[model samples]
Target: MSRHIAGDMQRYNVRPNCISPFAWSRMVGAIPTDTPEQQARVEKLKKLGTKQIAPLASDAAADVTAQIFAVHGNEIFLMGQSRPIRGMHTSAGWTLETIAGRVLPAMKQNLYPLESSNIVFS
Candidate 1:
């Protein structure tokens, strides 16, 4: 989306960029909890949320327009960068059986966190 916008608006001298913001909001109230322990954990999380502040619209817009600002490109401020952690290679080539038996096991130890989970929110 940011790239598309940047390309489309380039002719007009509009520098469209993207920023992944870490913010705290009333959305925390929507977390569902059943038991007292669960409710307490939710409350704790909600309290922690207060430390994260959302970007101000006027400030963010101005900073992005300035180009001298840090988040001028597709930048993430509070988060870390994506890096390749592990991989597996085979000189003899691989079949489904080999992938399931050999490569999978070899790569399993270096798999990304939550690689086994099926929880894909996107």
Candidate 2:
């Protein structure tokens, strides 16, 4: 969405970017901490304040557009764009068995972990 908006608004000199902020706020304070892992995550989140997000949203970011900036505490990350990392081709095409045996293994290393956002990012 940010990319699309940035592209469309480029003619007007509008730069649109997205900010995915992980800060300790009222909404985050309400997260359930029933589990040990959840409690640990909450503890980590407590260190990141809402003020940390202000810098990225300010005029300092005027030069960038069509980008996702993940702001956690004082850290800023330029998130990856949508692009293919790996591909495989077969002249004879593929059957289920061949895909399972060949393609899955070939792509397994590049596949993202099956974990929640907090677990993966934290």
Candidate 3:
């Protein structure tokens, strides 16, 4: 539930909003299939990302390349550094267990009224 900006685009100063994470909705660089553990897991999965978020891409490339998808409850957020990122809000409260186990981690920093740069929302 965080909207952060890091890795793959280390040239920028934006931090991954894991405190709120933002990343490419599509693939940007070579998909890191470096470790056996990662390859084993990727070998079985089809789509790299979720249905809601847009695939992340790299500016250094010509067109949309690989996709890096994200899943956040009912929706997904796309990763485009040049543009503003967005996320959907929950409609109801949840159980304490759910909050402790699930909800709190995804709780996003207020990203509204996109004027401020500290929390460049998505």
Residues 1-122 of candidate 1 have per-residue lDDT tens digits of 33556567767767644343323246656656788866865655443432223352345454343222222123334324345677678898989999999878878888667641113211
Two-way lDDT contest, 1 vs 2, winner: 2
Tens digit of per-residue lDDT, candidate 2, span 1-122: 35678889988878777788788878888989999999998898888887867766677767778888788877788888877899999999999999999999999999987876676575
Expressed as tens digits, the lDDT of each residue in 16-79 for candidate 3 is: 3321122223342334668896564444333333433322223432233223333443445444
Q: What is the C-alpha RMSD of each candidate to the true structure, in Å?
A: 8.9, 4.5, 15.6
TM, every model: 0.39, 0.64, 0.20
Measured by TM-score, the strongest candidate is 2
Candidate 1's C-alpha runs over 4 A off are: 1-32, 47-53, 56-77, 89-98, 112-122
Off by over 4 Å in 3: 1-29, 48-50, 54-122
Better of 1 and 3 by lDDT: 1
Lowest summed-lDDT stretch of 10 residues in model 2?
A: 113-122
Candidate order (TM-score): 2, 1, 3
Give lDDT: candidate 3, residue 29.
32
